[model samples]
Every structure is written in C-alpha cells, then in structure tokens.
Target: MHPRLIAPGALAAASVLLAIPASAASVSPGAPGIGDPYYPAYGNGGYDVSHYDLRLKYQPATDALEGTATILARTTQDLSRFDLDFLLDVDEVRVNGARAAFAASGEHELEITPRTPLAQGTAVTVVVRYHGIPSSKQAYGFTSWHRTPDGGVGANEPEAAWWWFPGNDHPRDKATFDVSVQVPDGTQALSNGTLQSTVSRLGWTRYSWRSDKPQATYLATLAVGRFDLTTGTTESGIPVVNAYSKDLGAQAGAARASIERTGEIADWLSGYFGPYPFNALGGYVPNTTTGYALETQTRPYYSPRQFANGSNTSVVVHELAHQWYGDLVSVAGWKDIWINEGFARYAQWLWSEHEGEGTAQELADYAYASRPADDPFWTVRPGDPGPENQFHIAVYDRGALALQALRNEIGDDAFFTVLKGWPQRYAHGNATVADFRGYAEEVSGASLGTLFDTWLFQPSKPTASAARTVSLVPAEAAPARPRSWQRIAATNGVHEH
Candidate 1:
C-alpha cells in the first residue's frame, strides 16, 4: 500500500472543512504542489511514460539543492502539446538538448509543447534544473532533510519527489525510473530499486538505483540518512536486503526471519498462482511517523513505527503480494482495482492457509458474512476517490471474497489454474475485470458471465442461492462435538454410518 496522504481518519474530518489552499502553500517538506503541483502532458492513447533519469545534488550545509532530469516519453498518436507534472523551483526546460519553452512554474504541474508536433511513438527528451531550500515541515517534489539531533523529519508526511525531478505526479501513469542522488559525505541515500552502484565524488557521495520495471509515480521513493545494509536470501533464492538507520540497533535475526517468511508465502502462492513477478525482492525499514508500508517495486518501504512484537507482520506480506498482483499485473484503470487489491488480499488469506490458521474458503466465508452487502467495497469505481479508499479493507477483503466465490463455483484446481496463468499472460501489463472473466472462462471451460455480472457489474450482492451443493463423500453422519461456529457441532455427540 502507498503511504497515507494524511493522518488516518483525518481526511474524512478535514473533508467537511475543505477549502483549497490559499496558494500552493507548503503543506510539508518536499511537497512542491502544496500551493500548486505539476500535471502530465498526456497523448491520445493515454500519457505514456518511457523513462526518467534524475540527477540531483543535495547540500545539507546550505539547506539547498540543484538537480536536472532527462525524461524520455512517447505517445500512442501524434500530438501538438501536453503537460508534465514536476515540482516547483524549476528554472529552465530543454527538449532534445534544445531550450524548450514551458509555463506554470511555482504551480503543481508543467505545461510544455515542442516547437514541432510530436508524432506517435516518437520519443521526447526533457530536461530541467533548479536550486532551492526545501521546507522541513512539508514534503514535495524533492524532500530535503537537515541533520537533526534525533534524525531527519521522519514523521513529516509531504512525500518529496517533485523537489528532485520532473515527471508525472499521479500513479495512473506507470513507467521505469532511474534515480541518482549526490549527497554530502557520510550520509547514505536510498531509492526504490535494486542499488545499481555508489561512488564518492569530491566531498559528496553519488548513489544510483534503477528499476527496470514499470512503477507508479508516487510509489517511487527515497530515504536519506546515515544507514547500514544487511543482506540475506529467501528460501526461493531471491536476494533479501534490509536497510536500517545506522544509529539504530541491529535486528538481523528478526529481519531475516520476516523476509524469509515472505519467500515462504510467495512459494505457497506459486502453487496456487505462479512465481512472484519482479526483478529483485526486499524492503527498507526507514524511521517514520506513519504506521503503513509501501510496495515500491523490487523493494518496499517499511516504517518501524507500524509493527510491534511482530504481531502485525502481515503488512510486509501484503505489500510483497502487491508486487505480483498490483505492480506487475496492474488494473487498467481505478475501476478495475480488484485486479490490484483483491488478488493481494487473497494472497494474505493464502498465507494464512499455509500457516494453518484457517482454510482459504473458511476465511473467505467469514469476510463475506461479516461485511455488509451494500458496503462501499462493492461500490468502488475507477476514479481518484482518495488514498483512504485506495486500500479500503472492503476492496481487499470483499474483493477477495469475489475471488472465493469463483473458486466455490469453479473448484480449486480450475481457480488455481487461472490464478497462475493471469500474471504469465499479462505480466508487466494492465488488465480489466472483463479480461479476467474472459481468461477464467476460457481456461476453466465454464461460463462465468453470471458470476461476473452479479459480483462485479451489479451494484449490490446477488440474491442467487448456492445452486452447487457440497457433500461429504460416502454420506456419513457424525455427532456434533463443538459448541460454536457450526450448528451441527453443538448438537449430536455420536457418529452414524
């Protein structure tokens, strides 16, 4: 899941008092669009993000920074102009190494047009640079942190990225990213992908990380603080590295155990689905005020504040599941969010099955029976409802229930076949509910129109009874042994054959 946009439950409370900021006020450090943010210049087949290479030099001494980005993008069709979402403080813009005209600086997004029309599939290279002291209170395009006595602004929530480079702002447009940050000596910088390399420059250290896969813009993240690295491997042979604050104590045992469990979960899922889909795998536990975690490509950003006694260890599992479900097999749009969230939620339940906590069907039945039918979980449409609704339990839980329904109707073997085949068919691509239905029907050789129509298209739960019946083989009756959960368990005590 992406980090919360605001404090939990705060958005709803603030919604009633909502009024646009007087200007793009500095809501927090690194938030360039506080007053105004950049929007992307999209083409007909939707804004296509090709690649982003950001070069930034951070100077904590003066609390200032300078950076430039070389963004390469192409369109599905010819277009005269478009918009790009970048952080404020940009001083110049160039296209193909030539100075390009751009407007709306100090605003949230940048509007840029090439001197000549850009044809479909033609790549456009853009570059921009600027210098400024990022606010410590808010987060924006680029997050700047000063060496504080305790640490940097860990709790401060304006996610800074715009302050560092120019590109799309929203998660709707997914693309590859390469980030290079140069900071003063002794301080280490971390970003989303597997670390490509690190070198020390004159009085500064440059670190570069590359994600060779498509990623949501907001899911791109970086953490700069004194840090130490601990590395290990999963049972399935994937590299698992943990990055923690250098000043903090070492928890290698805990980290290794938790990460290895992620592999175990993935392996169990592979039996039902396919292999986990990503280049590398691991996490970075940065000190933060938030209690949530993020699925940032090969690695996820985890906040230590969120877990206690490892009881809530499933957060990492949930995010790890996202790599296969959400990151690799993405939803075509927000409306098809089930493909992203619902599958991941089921992955958690699948993990529970592996742990012997409960059977998959039992858990699904529990979630479905507990939640209301008219709940917003069923009402989610593809739109920017808000971050609060992004990982809504309803979406994850109820969505999982929908999958369980299919399993019940089709049976385990067929359902697992669809689960394993989905990522292989649409790896690194987008999918819709219709695509899922078609694929499932095609694979299972069964008609699922009614299943999809009632579960996905219908606004409310269907009134259909369980037409399929379940019977224990050989038809033997046993005396009720327990007092709860099942009515039969509380009644008779002897078995009759």
Candidate 2:
C-alpha cells in the first residue's frame, strides 16, 4: 500500500482432496494475525481465501452500503473459530451453509465460530451479510471509506478493506474477486477487472466486475458516482477502461489527459518489467481531497490534486509501476515496503529517462549529492522503516538510490536481468526483502549483503563509493543536471504518499 498512501494490492492451493485425518483434527481458534512484523494484527489465520463474491448495494444519499460476501476458502488447519478482518455491522454469517455464531473482536476482527470444526485442507464456503455507513466507523484512528461529492470511494493503502467487506485482510491471503455494485440507475459504478454486465432493474443499476487474477483484499475497490467512462484498447490490444468524475470542474481536462495515457504508460512499463500483468487495465479520478494516488489493481485511483498543474504521467507511472512491483509481486510484510515504493518511485526516474527529460543516473546523482549526511532523511532506513516511516520519502528516493548503486555495482546487463526477472519469479505471490536480495545476488553473482545493508538497512548515508561516483554537498544545492523530475515527485507527490 503506497499510503502516497496510494494502495493495498496480494496465493494458491491444491484443488484435489487433501483432508486431514480424523485423529489429527484438533479444533482451535485461528490465530488473530498472519505474523507480519509491522502489522501483527492485520490478516487472520486458519483459512486461505480463494475468491470473494461481493454483492453490494450502495446509496449515495445516505452513504450506506449493504453487502453479502460469499467467500470460497480452505481451512489451513483444523478450526472451530476463524476471523475475517472487518469493521462493518454483520447481520448474519453462515459457514458451509450452516448458521454460525459470530461476534466482533478487537479493532478489526470479525470473529466467527462455525457450527462444526473444519478439517485442514478442506474447502468451505462462507456467506456474510453486513450493512453500515462505512464513513461512520473508525478503526486505528482513520477511515478509508471516503464520501465523495457524487458518491463513495473505498481506496487507501494498508487499511481500506476493513470498512467494506469481510475477508483475510493481509496481502498474504490473495483471492480472486467478483465485486458487483448496485447504485441508482443514473449513477455509475466501477471496480477492478473486466466489466461483465451492467443491468438496470427496479430503479437501480448493478455493475458486475470480475478479477480472474488473484488479488489482495485492499486492491478490491468500489467506486459509485456519476462518471464519464471511456473504453479503449492499447497498442498491444490490452483492453482499457478509464473513468472521470462528471463534476471535476477545473481539473477535468488535465485529469482526462493524464488518465487517458493509462494504456500507453502500461505498454511502456512492459518493456522493462515484461508484459502487463492483469487481464484489465485502466484508472479513475474522483473529485476528492485525498492527496495521494493508489495503484488499486487494474484501475489505479488518482487524486485530482495529482494533476492540478497539468498532466502528470510521473505519478501515473509510479502507481502503474506498482502494477508490477506492488500489485503483481506483493511485499510479504509491510516492513518490506521498499519493494513497493522504492521500485515504483524509481519508475518515475525511469520515465524521466524514457521521455529524454533526464537519465536515471543523473537523478540518482542529484539525490545522493543533495541530501546532507546529518539530515533525518538519511536516518529513515528503506528496508525496515518501521510502521511510522513505511511511506517516508527516504523509502522511495533512498530506496531508488540503493537500486542505482546496485545497477552500478552489477552493470546494466545483470541489473536489468534482476529488475525484469523479479516480478516474473514472484508473480502473484508474496515475498520479503530477503527474498529480493537473494534473487539479485543469484542473478548478478555478486555479494549484495553489505550493499543492501548500507543502502537500505543502515540509518546513515553510504560511505563506500564502490558503485557510481557522486560529489557530496552539505547544502541543498541543485545538481548540475536533472532537477525537473525531482520537482514532479517532491513538490506535490511525496506529501500525499
């Protein structure tokens, strides 16, 4: 989740029967967390979700949402009780078609005890009925549910899913999604994947969106409003659908210009990171004050502020790069945010290079030379920047600096190999920082432990000049070249994220 706070974006199991023996069935409550170091209480255990069929009805006037989530999953261990990370008011819960006792626990856990214990490796279907005004609920001090001028939007990094639907909330439990949103007939609804149908009946229009690729719960978004929708195909034949709020007064033209480039940018990114990953491609701009843009699966969310000046494809590149670094190959833990933000922010530099505005090395040199050794910017470790600094500017810039240093150390051929090969190696899967280090080391055949430590792990600037050379300065002096890209990111972009 970029929490530029940009997004939340996520696994698979055997289909054949592999049930636990009767003697091994020791029913117990599933663990409350999936063991993420930064977000220990985030996702739950006991079950691995495969798909979520969310049928929802939303009212813009009341800002109320009523949904029935039909979840298909498998118990990873014998479980008498399981939890779906949620904050909505649950009306009823049924496990395997049997009514189950459910209750609210802690800040975001919807605790449920099925009528019968589930054996390990056994498939189960769960249905949850819930209704609430999402904006009215608050957990961990903030709400991701956003009430817009036209309708409602559920898009944020790290914690948006809690207020909308019930499920395994962390990126580790990836699942396919069928999000069908019903709104007033005149209004439009948008979500991830290809739109299957738009049926109007009884004064309401139901829009059905399906994501065949395994997606994290946070990447599942719901946008209901009056929108001017555009559909097209990229040069490579990838279907593209972009949405713009009908009421984006001053920002309309610029937002449209930037968002229309979704397919083009995705195509450009493919050259360095392989093919576009998802079946669908697009983005949306809702008139909201939320200062960040998020890579919400296929359709990334863009704040109007992102384009206040004009078309800003750099921010678009950052989020779309997430389609690879953050969306396709998710971070195993929130602490490993460098894999997401660093790589994505680096994409902006690459975009600058692609446009002939500036080469990546020039930007890297500028970043390395500009920041003082004593600045707090150097202290925020990119690899393990704790909960508070997960989205810190250092994680993005310094993280990219780390990559540039690696590219210099390993040479362009091997660096590009590691860059393009990483997403393929861990596609649709979760991985940690250690996993990335190993992959790069394997590809370049160089010891990366100290390099990574100095660049990402240490709380101080790098002392070794083993890679590319840069002239350090004490002042915030502009480098001899490439200051435009920095303005694009630092001026309006970094604050939002």
Best by TM-score: 2
lDDT digits (tens) for residues 1-497 of candidate 1? 88856875787778744763432231221222212112212211324677888787766555566788788876545555556655457688886777767776444456666665556566778787766655432333333332332234211112335545556654445789888988888877777767888899778899998888887665676667676676666667766656766543344344444644555566556676677666567776655544456666677766554343343445566777778776777665555666866776677667666665665666655544444667665565312223435445556655776787788778888898898898889887777778888999998999988776655555554442531222121223332222222321111110000
In model 2, which runs have C-alpha deviations exceeding 4 angstroms?
1-25, 464-478, 490-497
**TM-score (all chains, Cα) for each model:** 0.75, 0.92
Q: Which ten residues in a row have the lowest lDDT in candidate 2?
A: 8-17
- Deviation of model 1 at 296, angstroms: 0.9
lDDT of 2 by residue, 1-497 (tens): 55453233301122122454554447789999988878889999999999999999999999999999999999999888999999999999999999999999999999999988888898999999999999899988888988899888998888689888998999989999999999998999999999999999999999999999989888888899999999999988989999999989889998999899999999999988999998899999997788888889999998888878887888888889999998999989899889998899888889998888877887887878777789999999999999999888899899999888888888889999988999999999999999999999999999989889989999998863533443343334466758566555643353353
Candidate 2 has an lDDT of 0.88
What overall lDDT goes with each candidate model?
A: 0.60, 0.88
Which structure among the candidates has the greatest lDDT?
A: 2
Residue pairs in steric clash, candidate 2? 1-7, 2-6, 3-6, 4-496, 4-497
